[model samples]
Every structure is written in structure tokens, then in C-alpha cells.
Target: MSELLEQFSAPPLIELESDLEALRKHAQKVLMQHGFPQRKTEAWKYTPIAALERRDWSSDGPDESAARTESIELPFDAHRIPVHNGQIDTSQLNEIDGLHIEPLRAEQIDTSAYVDHDPSDAFAWLNLARLEQGICIRVTHTLERPLALQFSSSDQFKQAAHPRIRIELAEGVEATLFEQHRLHGSGLINLVMDLQLAAGSSLQHLMQRQNDESALIARTEAQLEQAAHYQAYVLDLGGALTRQDLKVHLNESRARTRIHGVAALKDKQLVDYHTAIQHRVGPSHSEEDFRILADNHSMGVFNGRIHMLPGADDSHSDMNTANLLLSEHARINTKPELEIHAEEVTASHGATVGQLEEAARFYLRSRGLNDAEALALLKFGFAAAAFDALESEPLRQWFTDRLKQAL
Candidate 1:
């Protein structure tokens, strides 16, 4: 743990301004005090970081000229922001009306809310301490096209990079955010994202990630105000080591959020997802559905938790997770929890893990489809249902096509 910490605490690749330097120093102090999570940590027990600790960060990374890999081609037109090897290429940023992009301000970052005294939040603190690039995006009106954030790493990339991003939506604004990650090589990318939604605002958030070698760790925190609505859809194919934590806070009455995600894993990949939704006021609502399909020697983990605070009367929430193990060696751990402390509040949670039904597979095989084809169709059908609530037809179709290919 100390070795890894030393590597992460090395001098920043880019010099920091005075305000950012102070924040970084504080974050570094807190991180060093807590260190990293160990095997006994409940939240990290199933996910190991031994591989990350073994990495040698002394090698020179990819050449700066070759760091920018080709941008991913999107099915729909969008205002694109391309980040290559953890560096945003400002030249590629598109100018769109009603949208603004600028460097992240030191005042916008507040790490006091994180549980820094514990190792569970060590990665979040590490991100703040070693952040290389930071950006803030603002949306003030309905967007004609989606805003796409494309992140890719080169094949020779071998250094850890930290990037922070914040998205702010003004009151009564409506927009769509499409985030894609394509990672290669054997480096690490630690990311932190903040989402702020004002009153009467609506945001459609979509995420798609595919990686096989690199390690990816990310945390996303969102706060929604009165009458704000936030919908998130995530599709993660697989990776060598992937861990994501998503938390949403409904701070005012009538605020609502829905999350739907699917993780498809194969080979020796590992993917862990932890999501929490908090109803802090009266009459808020939240719904979540996540599915995982693990094949080969892969392992998958999902933990979904919902909390209704004392003053959150009339709040309602539902959470569910379904998992399938496609091979004898594959493993899955899923847990759904609900904590309610308010009167008249309603909450429900469930989780299930099982293999494919033999009877259904036999029926499909008897109908002329080969064994492999039948299996693919069944898996696709099971995973695709999670995205049924997506509003955009094109985006839904895109997700469907990607899922089919992934299977």
C-alpha cells in the first residue's frame, strides 16, 4: 500500500496554481493518513487492487504526439469533447450555443464530504491530490444535439492519470450527456465527476465503456434540486479491473432519479459497481435496475443501497439487481439494501443470481438455431430489457447494437 501511495503521490505532471496547490496538499495529507483499502474493508473485499500495486510506473509513457488516439465515431451528431490519455484536447472542443466549457475552479471542489478518514474513500482522495486536468461544463438551455465526452487511451500508455469533471445544468434546462470510454494498454485512469441539477431541470446521462487491459476507477456524485429529474443509463462491457461508485442525492421535494445499468464480462475481467440514492426531503422518488452477465473466469459485483432520511416523508424508492453466471468458473456477488427512517415512505429492494434456464435453451436449440446463436439471443434479451425506459430511440438502438456485439 505504501509503495502504491508513493507512486501516486509523486509530483504532479503539471504545475498547480496557488489555490489548487493548497487543496492538493490537504488532499495529500488526508490520503496519506488513511492509505488504501485492504482485504478486510467491507466495500472493497470482493475487489482487489494487488494488480494495481504491482504496476511499474517508472517507464516512460506514450509519446505526446501519439497520445491522441482516433476519436470514436458516434451514431448521432453531437458536440464532442475528446480526452486522450487523460488530457483534454481543447482544440477539438466544439462551440455550441447554450453550452459553456471552462477550466475547473479550485473553489468548486470540496473534498470534506468524503469519508476521508477511512480507506474506502482513498481513491477519491487520491484523485483530488494528483489531478492532472479539470474541466467544468454548463448547460443553460435545451440542447439541439447531445453533448458527447469521449475518453480514450493509447496502446503504449503506462502512467496513472487523474481527471476531474463537473457538469452543471441551470434551472429549467434540458440536455443529454453521452460519455464513452475506450481504454487500452496497462495504465490507470482515476476519474471524478460531479453533477448539479437546478430546479425544474432534466438531464439524460448515458455511459458506455469497453476495456480489456487498463484499470479504471471512477466516482460520480450528483445533487438534484426541486422538481429536477435525472436519468442515467450505463453499459460496461468489461475490463481488467473496473470499479465505479455512483451516488445521487435528492435534496428537494419532487426531485426524482432513475438508474439503469448492464455489465457484460468475459475472460478474466472484474467489474464492481456500487450505487446509492438518498432521499433527503419529502416526496422524492428513485428507481434502479442493474444486471450483470459473467462468462469464462470473470467476476462481477453489484451493491445497490437506498436511504430515506428522517424528514423524507412520502418518499418512494425501488431497487433491483439480476445476475447470470455463464460458466462454472464465473462468479457474481449482488446485494440490495434499503434504509428508511421516515413515516409513510415506501422502499423495496431485491437481488437474484442464477444461470440460464436449460429448458429455454433446449427449446431454442430444437427450433433450428445453433447452440451458440440461441445462447447469444437469450443473453441479449435478458440484458436489453434494462434499457427499455430510455427515451431516445437512436440512443436506445445504439445501446442495443452495442449489447448485441458485446454478447
Candidate 2:
């Protein structure tokens, strides 16, 4: 508690100054009461950020209409929602059927009703405290095309900004989502995503974060109803300090979820990925697969756990993490765990960390490739397996291009 308390000199005083926002007020209260997560907190043990608790933490609020208009858009054509500097720009939003975008107004609804986030989670509390008209995305019906969420940031100060995103899928709705984080500058960005998938609904979300200068801490919470399916594919290639925490709740029977992510890091960058899936009812299942490529003096950490309650019989869960260290100084820490209280459940977990397979490199070299070319080919192939998990071919190509740039 003392270590986290030293990270901040004030308790979100900017949020306390605002009287118009109920969410901010509530979060301000939480911040004042709990402050931040300490080093003793097991969930945050691997991620101890020094900059986040700094006194200069501040945001410039929503971007102007001019800035949103002048900024460049993604190359591919899709239903795009651009959020720059923590402010959503709806000027060019695509009018997709069954999709609704609105401001998270203070007078509209209470934050507690829509969120399952932990109150003690420091960044989540900070995001709620400093949030300004964060976007609410809701899908009511089936959508043929994929939706793109473009989160961009431009801050070079010793400060930071918090962005809150909420996504709700109504019953029987099925949609594909694309989210990309394009960042510039050397500040901090805290983001929270709340996902609600109703009965018979399914969501396939693909995300990529490739910005080296900024420090990013992200959290995701997904709640799945009966027979609902949720799948996420994440690619992290950049950021000075990147940490992502993901939690999934299978509240009903036969719910299915899969979380697969790949991270390629270099230089002195650090990346931490954590996930927890709870099977609250019977016959639910989940699978998690992650791969990390570490080079230079970079570091990567992965921790995944699956929990099955007493009633969660007939469920199955599996997790596997594989890491390749490209440099002697690179480091990777991996932990995969499972807790099953049900007799009929099956669960397994494993992790592996080492250099590239010498046999594979030799095989590639024998096929008319030099040492450098063979290494490049092997690394590309290693990334391709996970990056190609997306159902969309164009999206995979777009991600491949970004990977090339980042790596």
C-alpha cells in the first residue's frame, strides 16, 4: 500500500473538482479510499509502474472537431470509430445496422450497472475518475461487416490520459470487431473495455497495439451468457511498458471462449499479459494460447488461470504459452494455472521458453537461405501462425504490415 501511495501525490483532484459527473465522483471516492494497488498485491506483482502514480497525471479532455477531421484514418475501408486523445470523434462514424454509439453521460446510467471491474484495480478506478464522455458501443443485431475501433494518442508530457470503452452485444447478435491502438509520444495511456455478450450472442474481436513510445495499461472484462461465444485475438508489438489484464466470466451453461495473443518485443520494452477465466456453470469451456518473441534486452510476462466452480461440471479448459528469446539478455516469465472444484471438469496448462529451434534453422538454411534470412524467415513463420488466426484475410494482411513495421 505504501509503494502505490508513493506513486501519487494527490487523489485524482481534477475529478474531485467536477460536480457534474456522478461516475467521476464515485471513482474519486474509490481513489481517495483505496488509493492504488500496492506491490504486495499478487495480481499486480509483475507490473509496478512508476509513472502512473506521478502527480502530473492529467488529460487535455476531448479533442476538438478540427483535430478529429484533420487526423489521418486507417488505410482499409471499414466501419471506423476514431478516438483520439481519449475523445471519440463521431464525425465519420459508419452507420452500421444494429450498432449504436453514444456518450457515457453522467445522467444516463450508473457505471456499476454496466461494469464488473474491480474497485481496487488502480487503473480502472483512475479511468472512471478522469473519464469524459467515454463511448458506449452497443450492437443489437447481426452485422455482416467488421467494425473498427481506432484508439489514437498524442501526448508527450509527463502526464497521461484514461480512455473507457464499453461494448454490449444483445441476445442472438453476432459481430466481428477490430480494435487498433496507434500511439505517439512518451506518456501513459490507461484503457478499460467492458464487454457483455448476451445469450446466443457471439463476438470475435481482433486487436493490435503497436506504439513504442507510450506506456499502456489495459484491462478487459467479458461476461458471457448461456451458449454465448467470445473470442479475442491480440497482437502486441510496441510500447515502453505494456500490461494487459483480461477476465472472462462464463455465467451460464455451454458458454465458450478463446483468448489467443502474440507479442513481439524489442529494445528495453516490457510487456505483461494476464488472464483469468471463471466457469461459473456447467458444460462451459475455454482455451488460451499465447506466444512471445523477445529480443534485445526486452522482457515478457504471461500469467493465465482458469477456475471451475462446484457447479461447473463437464467443462474443459486448456492453456499453453510458448516464448522464444532472441537475445541472451531477453527474458520471459510464464505461468499457466487451473483450479477445478468440479469432478467432471478437465483442465491442463503448460509453458515453454527457449531460443529458436536449431534444427528448424538448419532446415531453413539448407533450403538456399543464409543465416540472417533463415532467422528472419523462422521469426516470420512463428508470428504468422498466431496472427493468421483472424477470420478476415484483409485484417490479417493489415496486421502483418503493422508487424513488419514494428518488428
Candidate 3:
């Protein structure tokens, strides 16, 4: 325990803003009560932190070096916002009406508005305390084009980056947002994203994280007002250790939210997807669909939880998890939990983990295609459930092509 403290030096209170300082003190108090998350911690049970402790969390904030760097563009048409090591590069921000993108200072942000106080969420605690700067996004009117946030992180030695994002969507407005997390070197990335949707708003969010020899911990927090709708999809491919946590609160009546993802893993990679949805009021709905493809010695975990609060009458919630393992050593753990307090709510969950059907493989082989090709096609078919849910056609094709390439 003492060694862990030695590895990390907490920032002095004087260096933090008044608002941030208060949050930091609470975080510090929590850390003192519960040290870094251990295996016993429910959320951190599947993730290993020993590899993360070997490195140092130091972004040093942003500097002139960010101005000279360039972000690699994707094969999509959208307004791009490049973030280097968790800090947005203002020089690369494009101009767009009804959209405001800029740096977020500690003094200007309300920590409680985004992240909840979770004593067991070590990465979020660290993000709240060590966050130096981040990107803030606000959408007033309906957006004309999709907005993409390109996150790139690289470090020669073992380092860390904590990038924070706050998004606000106005009432009756609708928009699409994309995030691409591209890791270039060996390091740990702690990312936090908070989204708030007003009444009658709609938002579609897509994020893809691909990395090698790196560790990542990401948390997404969202709240939907009355009659609002939010749809989100995430694709996680290849990482030393990666865990993505999504928590959404349906605070008003008639709110709807859907979050799904695919973690196509390979080699010795590890990926864990955790999600929680709270139906706090009546007539709300939530659903989660997650699929995994584990090859080689990779491991994947999916934990979906649905909660119906006391007043959540006539709410509907469902969760489905499916995994396809291609190798004998490949493994996956899936759990779907439902807690209901209201009598009129309907909730259910299902999970399945298996390999390719030999009978189907034989049928395809008899049709002239080889075994490799047959399995590849079958794997693609298995992922179609989540693929078809994607709102972006180009992304759907890209993800399909990449999945084939991995095979």
C-alpha cells in the first residue's frame, strides 16, 4: 500500500482551482478510505491494474508541441476535433455553426455535473483529480454534419493521459458524434465523457478504440430528459488491457436509450465492457446489445445491469450478450443483471458464448469455399446483430472489412 502511494504523487491543493480543489479533496478522501481498486472490486474484477501501476500518469498539460502535431483523418466526412494525449489541439478545430468546441478549464467546469462519486471507480477518481485540461462541446441548434473527435496518444516511456469531455445537446436538437481513439505507443489512457440531453433531444454517438501494447480505461456518463433519445455504439479492437464503462440515467418519463458494442479481440488482448442503466421515472426504456469475437488467447467480459427505481412504472429494459470464440484458449465472461422495484416494469436478459457450428462450416466447405473462408463468413454473420445497429454506413462497412482482415 505504501509502495502504491510512492508511485503516485498527488498534486498540491494550491495548484487546483477552487471548484476543482473541492472535488479533489472529496476524491482524496475517497482514496484514503478505499485505495486503488483491487480485484475484489466488482467493476475492476476483470481488469488487471498491476500493469497500470508500473507507469506514471503525467500529461504535463498542453504546450506548443501540440500546435505542430497533425491528426490522421479518417475515411469519413465530418468536422474533426483532434485531441492529442487528452488535450484538444485548438489549431485543428474546424468552424461550425451551432457547435462550440474549446478547452475546458477546471474553474469553469462542474465536476459533480458529469462524474458521480464512486469510491470503487479508481480511474474516474484519478481523472477527476489529475485532469489538467480537456475539450468541451456544446450543441445549440440541430447540427448539419457529424462531429468527430479524434483522440491520439503516444509516449516514448511509460506515461498516462486523462482526457475529459462534456457534451450538451439542446432541446429538440439532433446530432451525430463520432470518437476515434488511436493509440501509438505504450501508455495508459484514462478517459471520461459526460453527455446531457434536454427534453425532446436526439443524439447518436459512435466510438472506436484500437490499440496495441497499451492500456485504457474509459467511462461514459449520460442522462436523458423527458422524451429524449440517445443511441450509442462502440467498437473496441485489440488492446493490452481495455475496459469501457457506460452508465446512463433516464431521469424523466418517456426517455429512451440504447447502447451496444462489439469487441473483436485477438492475440493476448483483453477487453471488458460494463454498462448500467437506471430507469428512474415511468414509461422509460433502455436496451443493451453487446457481441464479442475472441481469437487466440484473448479474453472478453460483458456485464450489463438494469435498474428500475421506485417510481419507474411501465419501464422496459432488456440486455443481450453474444460471444464467438475461435480458439480453444479464447475465453469470455458475460453476465446480465436486472433489479426491479416497480411492479409494472418489464425486464429480461440473455447471454450466449460459443464457437462456430461445425455443421455450418461443413455446409459452406461443400459449397467450394475453404474452411478458413467459411468460418470468416460465419464470424461476420455472428456480428451482424450489432453491425446492423450502426447508424453510419461507412463505419459499418469499415468495421466489417476490418473484422474480415483480422480473420
Candidate 4:
């Protein structure tokens, strides 16, 4: 531990050496197999994970001892499920009818690869190796109120956490899910959430992460059944470093999906969001909207891919990405891709890289608003459209307040 700490000087990776060897081996193997994605790689041209390989960072299991006593907030009147340092805090969980929360056993889940697009995803393999505990949430038919799951960590020296979330929403049922990430100290958090939505079911997911000088790595994979509806909202605040990978599969016709993201970064923090939505069947629809604000020397990266397979026709999809470069040194890279193997589809993408309009700012200032107030108003207005789509009212308000504080 001493030698590792001396070499890297980061509190999180220092503690990962002795936690679990199996996870380390798997992570290394996946890294070697997949290698570092570079500019040549179409999916990783804008944001490369090569730096991770050169850094010699270690990813061990999470230590439950380092978690702070305080818990993060949830969105609705919910049954809170807390995972502290990769260990489920069942004591705080409230038993609710029509819902089941339990540890996920290896036999209960299928570890087989679901998608063949990325066979050697080092991050996915890392999650498979270090997953100490899996939280299973079954939303039965009668469940109505939102379910909130919180992932918190305070271990600055701990290596990595592969916390898995398996959510099963039964047929004809509806539920809202809130996933929040909170880091008390600086550390690396590698987490994966797998969701299964049954036929005629609906699921709303809101993912939030607010890190103070920490590195967070997260991946979410979701499968939607026929006629299922999925809505997702992602908000990423500044961190020492961060990366989020999201993959959604519209496996059946008439499945509707929408993804919205907001990112605010400053200082030297780096944040990246990568999303892939695949329409394997015909008659599915998808829309994506993202807004990013980068200040100081921060960097924001976004890569979105929409795929329509052969024989999949009548699919309608649209994507728009808008970025705000708040400083001369701040940077943002936006990539929107559409791969259409079918011709009878309406698909389009648009991306913009610019700052707030000076004229708009001046007009706001002339209307009795100070420079700071005017900027805040404009920022709020820019993000308000997407924020209003949040299914939970309290969650939307909480994020709004956070955005105000951020500005």
C-alpha cells in the first residue's frame, strides 16, 4: 500500500491492491484484450481511454469501513436502498409491498455477453470481476411510487467498486428509478446497472453524480421489451475525472426511448458521456438531447451512436447536442453518429459548439439583472427544457438548486 500510494498519490487506487485479486486479473485481461481505444477507433476518437493504461492505476474491491455515516437524498417518497462502499446497507432499507430488494446471487444472473459490438470492454469485465454485491429490485405490478437507490463511498484509498444493480419491472407495471452517486473523498468508482423492462412496462431512470475532486466510472446497460418505454436523464457535475457509458437496446417494435444529459464542469475536471442506442427490430423510436457547460480548463466529451439494423424500417430518430464553452481554455468534443442499414427511416443528428450569445447576455443585463444573475438566468433557461422532463418533481427541483449553486 505504501509503495502504491507513493507512486500514484491518489487516495482511491492506493487501497485496491489487497482487496481482491480476481478482479485485478479480470481488469487486466480485459484491458489487454480490448487495449486502449484510440483516435483510430470510431467510437473512441474524441475521448480516448489510453491514459488509463499508462497510469498504472489499480482497481480492487471497495472497503465498507471508509463510507461516511451520512446518506444521500432520494427523489420521491421512496424505499431507499443504500450501497455503502460496494456493500449494501440493508439496515436502512424499508420493506415495501410489490417490491423486492435482495442481494443478487451469481446463479440468478446471466453473465453471458449480451452484445457483441464490444467484446473486450475492459470496464465491463472489471465490473464482472469486482462485483461484491448485487442489489436486485423487483417492481411488481402494484408498485407505484418511485424507488430510489443510492451508491455512496468515502474510501479515498480504496481501489474500485463494481456495484451491480439489477432491476426487473414486471409486465404492465410502471415505476420511476433514481440512481445517485456520491463520493465523500477522492476515489475511483466503477459501477454497472442492468435493467430489464418487460412488455407493456414503463421505466424512468434519473442518474446523478456530484463528485468533489474524485474520479467516477459508471456503465449502465438496459434491455427493453416490446412496447416498453424508457426515459433517462443524466446530470454530471465536475469531478477530478469521470466517464459514463450507457447502452440501450430497443429489442421490440414500438419501444420508445429518450435520453437527456446535462454536464457542468470547471477547474481541471474532466467528464465524458458515451451512449449507444441500438434498434434491432423495426418500428422503434428514439430521441436524444444533451447540454454541456465547460469552464476553466475542464473538458466535456459526448459520443452518441444510433444503429438501425437491416430490415428495420419506419424507425424515426433525432439527436441534438449543444455545448457551452464558458472559458477560453475549456474544451468540448461532441460526436453524433447514425448507422442505418435500412433505408426507410427518418434519422438525423445535429451538434453545436459555442458559448452563450453575448447579445442575449447583454439584453438580460439591461433588464435589471447583474452580470452574474444574467448569466445564471441564461444558463437556467438553456437547461430548463430538458430539466422539465424529469418524472419526479422533487428530483427536478433538487437538480435545479444544484445547477443554481453550480453557476
Candidate 5:
């Protein structure tokens, strides 16, 4: 942990923003006090940071050649915000109606909730302490097109980059947020995102990520007001090392959220996802579904937790996770938890880890399909159920196509 602290020191990166100096100092203090998570850290025990500690980040700095100038190609039409090597190209930002984009100010960020002396949150604090690029995106009216955030890294990228972003939707606003990550090289991309949904607002969040040798650690925190709706769809194709923590708080009545995710891992890749949904008020709802397919020597982890607070009466939640181990050496760890404290509330959770059924595979093979095709079909059928509830046909098709390609 101390070695990681030394490697992640801020002095050698970029200078801290003057306006956020105090906050950065506070974050640094918290990290210094607790350091990074160790083997005993429950939340991070399955995901090791030893690979990060061994890297020499002394020569990791911004390089002019790392700038990406090509536009990201997407299957759908949308507004794009491109982040190259963890740096946003401000010059490419264009004006869009009903949307306002600006540099994130210190006032827009509050680290009080995550600045505690808990080593499990050390990465969250480290993001604040070493943040180099920050952006604030606000939606004032319903958007006709999805807002896409494309993040990619150059093959030469070997430096760690921390990027922070805040997204807010005004009352009655309806928008779609598309986040795509395609990273390469052996560096680290530690990202933090904050989301705010006002009353009567709706946000559909979609994410697709595929990486090579880079390591990605991302944390997203969302707060939903009265009658707000938030939905998330994720497709992770694995990487060298990946960890994501998503926490959503239903702060007011009638707030609801649904999360669906799939992690397809192969080779020596590893992916870990930790998601928590908090029903803080009455009449809130949440549903989560996650699937993982690990092949070769890959590993996958999924932890989904639902909490119904004391005053969250009439709230309901259902969480489920299904994982498949495709090889003898492949491993998967899945846990689904439900903690209910309120009366008149219903919550159910289930987790299962198993392999493909030989009967089903044999049946598919008997239907004129080869062994590889039958296996791929079986894997796709098991994993595609997570996205069955998606509302958009195009998005559903896109997800299915990507899943097929990944398989």
C-alpha cells in the first residue's frame, strides 16, 4: 500500500487546481492517514493491486503525440465528447441545444461523503487528490439524441490518469448517457463520476468497455430525487485488471432504478463489479441483473446489494446474478445481498455460479451447429437475458451484436 502511495503521488503529475487545492489537500490527508486497501479489505479482497504497485510511474506524463484527433465511430447518432488518454479535448466540444457543458468547478464537487479514513475508499479519494481533468454536464431539456462520452487511450500511453465528471438532469428532463471506453497500453485510468437526477427526470445510462493491457478503476455515485428514474446497461469485455463500484441512492419517494450488466472475460483478464442500491425513502424501487462468463484463466466477480432503510416503506427490490465458468482454471465469485429494515417492503436476491449444461450443448450440436457454434450460442443465450428488459430496439440489437462478437 505504501508503495502504491509513492507511485500515485501527485507532485510528478500535474499541478492541482487552485480552486480545488483545499479539497485536494483534504483528500490527500485522508489517503495518507489510511493508505491503500490491503488484502484484508473486504470490498477489495478479490481484486489485488499488486500489479499496480510494481509499475514505475515516474516517466508518466502528458505527451503531445497521445492526442487523438479522429472522431469515434458509433452505431447511432449522438453528441460526442471524446477523452483521449484521459484528457478531454476541449477544442472539439460543440454547442448543443438544451445542454450546457463547462469545466467542473470546485463548488460542484463535494468529497465529504467519501473522504473518510477508510482504506476501501482510498481510490475514490485518490481520484480527487490527483484529478487532472474535470467536466460538468447539465441537461436543461429533453434531448433528442443521446450524449456519448467516448474514452480511448493511445497505444503509447503508460501514465496513470484521473478524470472526474459530474452529470445532472433538471426536472422533467429525459436524456440518454452513452459511455464507451476502449483503452490500451499498461497504464491506469481511475475515473470518478457523479450523477444527479431531479424530480420527474429520467436518465438511461449505457456503457461498453473493452481493454487491452490497461487497468481501469471507476466509481459512479448517483442521487435520485422524487419520481426520478435511472437505468443502466453495461457490457464489459474484460481487461488486464478492471474494477467498478456503482452506488445509487433513491433519496425521495417514487425514485426508481434498474441495472443490467454483463462481463465477458477471457485469457488472463479480470473484472470486478460492486453495485449497491439504497432505498432511502418510501415507495422507491430497484432491480438489478448481472452476468459473468469467464473463460481460459480469466476471473470475474460480482457483488450486488440492496438496502431498504427504516423509513423506506413500500419499497421493493430484486437482485440476481448468474455466472458461468467455461474452463477448469476460470473462476467466478458472485454474491447477492438484501437488507430490509422497513415494513411493507419486499426484497429478494439470488446468485448462482455454474457451467454450461451438457444436455443443452448436445441439443444445439444436434441441430446442425458445430461445437464452437453451439458453445457460443449457449453462452449468448445465458448472458443476453440481462439485457432483455432494455427499451430500445436498436440498443438491444447493438448489445446483442457486441455480445456475439465478444463471444
Candidate 6:
């Protein structure tokens, strides 16, 4: 390595340096080679990674005490697995039928896993380096009910933790899962979830992030086989700065995917959601819907890409994004793309940035509500679209209330 490369490749923290030196060097080298994203990188134009690159992060292992105090609640009384500071709490784990949760093994590490994608993705490398322990969940044939995996961070300070998750759904299986993150710390939280859905399987993955005034970088990868159905919903409500990347591939025909997201920001927080979907086979469908509310100098970003392979004929996809700017200084950026190699496909995208509708506000005010009340009502209506799509009533109510309080 060159002098500059050698310098950047060295991690100052002794814990990380001692535990995973090779992985750390390899990860830092990738970041040094491809620095934080710039305008040239289409996928990262809206959410810059420069801030994350400058931070020096290290891990101190999992705190069993903090992990014990962390609690998470989902809409369903399903199997709960809590991961604190990147380590799963084995004591709190409960056994469930058709589901097996275990620690990730070294044999599972495959560097070629990201050969085709952006090698410099800092979080990806960071997770790879610090991923000491992770949960391996296998959903057997046709799950009896939904399952939930909760990752909670309670450490407060400059810290780093890598939590790796691998979910394998067998053929003909079906599951609705809530992958949640709760952080009370003020450091970097890097997570990577690798998922595989077998033929004729279906999965519903919902993500919620409720953290302190901390920064978070999260990435997820999913691979789907023939006739697989995958649906995702992401709700970002808390964090000083948060960014999530999703790479999904439909490797076989007749596969369908949908991504629905909602981001509510306040108090100078920044949130970004980027997604890429690739259809490698014929006749696949995908749809994306995103809603954002930014207030008090907060920022929100939405970037989505849909790719149709050369032989993927008769594919249909659409992306719709809407942003609500609650403060004058708040910013919202949306980028939607469609790359198609096939001649027969229906693809479209729509994006809009605006404030509350004066007409609606006026009508509500005239109907005897005060200005604040009217504005609150209008805002609630705007943010309710995504909540209505949720199958779990409690989760829907939880998000709705959080959104209202955020506004």
C-alpha cells in the first residue's frame, strides 16, 4: 500500500486493532481507495458520506448489562431476539417453531459477496470488520406466524458496533418480520442484514429506527428466487444522522417486491434512504412509495433505482415520493431512476416537495379548528398513508403517534 493508503488503513482503537486487524485493514483500504461519495456517484448524490468517513470508530465488545436493559415491543407477540452493541442476547432468546437463531460463523464470510457492487461502501466494510458475533436465523417451511428481531444500542459515547444478520427462508415459507433498532447512544451504529428467500417464499420485512442524537449507517442485501415475494417498510424517526441502503435482486421470473418508507425528522436530524432493485429475469414487478417530514433544520433524502434486465420483458414498476417541509430551513431531496434493457416494460416515477396545503388548512380552520390544530390535522393525514399499509395495528398506532409528536 502507498504511504497515504497505509495511514488511512490503520485504525487507532486497540480493541478493534487486536480483534480483527486483517478485516480492519481491508475495510479501511477500501474506504481510502474510494472516499466518501460525491456528485459523480449517482446513488449518493443526495446523502453525502463525508461526515461518516472522518470519524474514527472502534468497538469494545458487547455490554451484557446494557443488553439486558434494552427492551423492544412490536405489534405482535412474536419471538424476540435482542442484539445489544452488536451481540445477540442469548439468555433472553426464546425458541420458536420453524425458526433457528444462532451466531454467525466464520465459514459464512465470503468476500465475493459484494464484488458486483460499490466496494467503498463504508458501513459494509465496517460491519465486515467488526462483525464478531451475529444472528443466523433460518425460517423453516411455511412459518406458523411472524417473527421479530430487535437490535438495541444503549451505549452512550463514541463507540462502534457491527451487527450482522443472515435470514434464510426456505422454499414455500412465509413470514412477516420486524427488524427494529433502538439506540440511546451517541456513536456510530453499523448494521448489515443479508437475506435470501427461496422459491415460492414470501417475506415482509419492516424496519424502525429509534435512536438518540447519534449517527447510524445501515445496509441490507436481499436475494429472491423464482415466484418470491418481498415487501419492506422502513420508518426512520430518530437519529442525529441516519442513512440506510438496500440492494434487492429478483433472480427469477414472476418475483415481486415493494418498498414503502416514512421518515419523520426534527431537531437538526438528517435521514436518508436509498434503494436499488434489479430484475434479472422476465416478468417482475416492483413499486416504491416514500413519505418524509422534515422540521427544524432537519434533512431528508430518498433515492431509488429500478433495473430491468435485457430479457426481462413485460416488467412494471413505479416510484412515488412526497416530502413535507415543516420548517423553512429543512431540506428534502429525492432521486428516482429507471434503467431498463428490455423493450417491453412500464416504468414511472413521481416526486414532489412542498408544504402544507393552504387550502386544506384554511378549510379546517374555517370548520372551527385553530391554526395549530388545523395544521396538525393536515400533517397527520399526510403521514397516515404508510401507516395504513401496515398489517399490525399496534405498530401502525405506534408510528402514527410518533409521527404526530415529531411534527
Q: What would the TM-scores of all predictions be? A: 0.97, 0.86, 0.90, 0.85, 0.96, 0.87
TM-score of 6: 0.87
Q: By the TM-score metric, which is better: model 1 or model 6?
A: 1
lDDT of each: 0.89, 0.76, 0.78, 0.73, 0.89, 0.75
Model 4: how far residue 56 lies from native, Å: 9.0
lDDT of 4 by residue, 8-32 (tens): 3232332233334444455545554
The candidate maximizing TM-score is 1
In model 3, state the lDDT of residue 357. Answer: 90
lDDT of 5 by residue, 1-407 (tens): 77788778845546656878877888888898999888888999888888898876767455757554545557788888887788876454467778888888999896766738579888999998887778998999898899888888877777788889899999999999999988887788999999999999999999999988888999999999999999999999999999999999999999999999999999999999999899999999999999999999999999898989999999989899999999999999998878888889988888899999999999998989999999999999999998999999988999999999989
Per-residue alpha-carbon lDDT of candidate 3 for residues 83-202, written as tens digits (9 for 90 to 100)? 766566656455668888766666545445433444467677777666666667889989878788887766442456667888889999998888887765666678888888999999
In model 5, where do residues sit more than 4 Å from their true spots? Answer: 10-19, 62-71
Candidate 1 displacement at residue 265 in angstroms: 0.4
Structure candidate 5, residue pairs in collision: none
Q: What TM-score does prediction 5 earn?
A: 0.96
Q: What lDDT tens digits, residue by residue, belong to model 6 across residues 1-407?
A: 13323323334444433335566567666665664456566666656555654554454544556444756866667667776655566564456668777766655544555532453465577577555566678888666656667877665435666678889999989988888877766556677888889999999998888776556778888889999999998888857778898988888999889898888888878888888999888898898889988888888988888889898788888888888999999999887888999868999999888899889999998999999999888877887787677776877787787667765
Q: Relative to the unseen true structure, what is the Cα RMSD of model 6?
A: 3.8
TM-score of 4: 0.85
Q: Against the hidden true structure, what lDDT does model 2 obtain?
A: 0.76
Off by over 4 Å in 3: 10-16, 56-73, 102-119, 155-157
In model 3, which range of ten residues has the least summed lDDT?
5-14
Q: How well does model 1 score by local distance difference test? A: 0.89
Q: In candidate 6, where is summed lDDT lowest over 10 consecutive residues?
A: 1-10
Error of 5 at 35 (Å): 0.7
Ranking by TM-score: 1, 5, 3, 6, 2, 4
**TM-score of candidate 3 to 2 decimals:** 0.90
Looking at candidate 2, what is the lDDT of residue 396?
A: 78
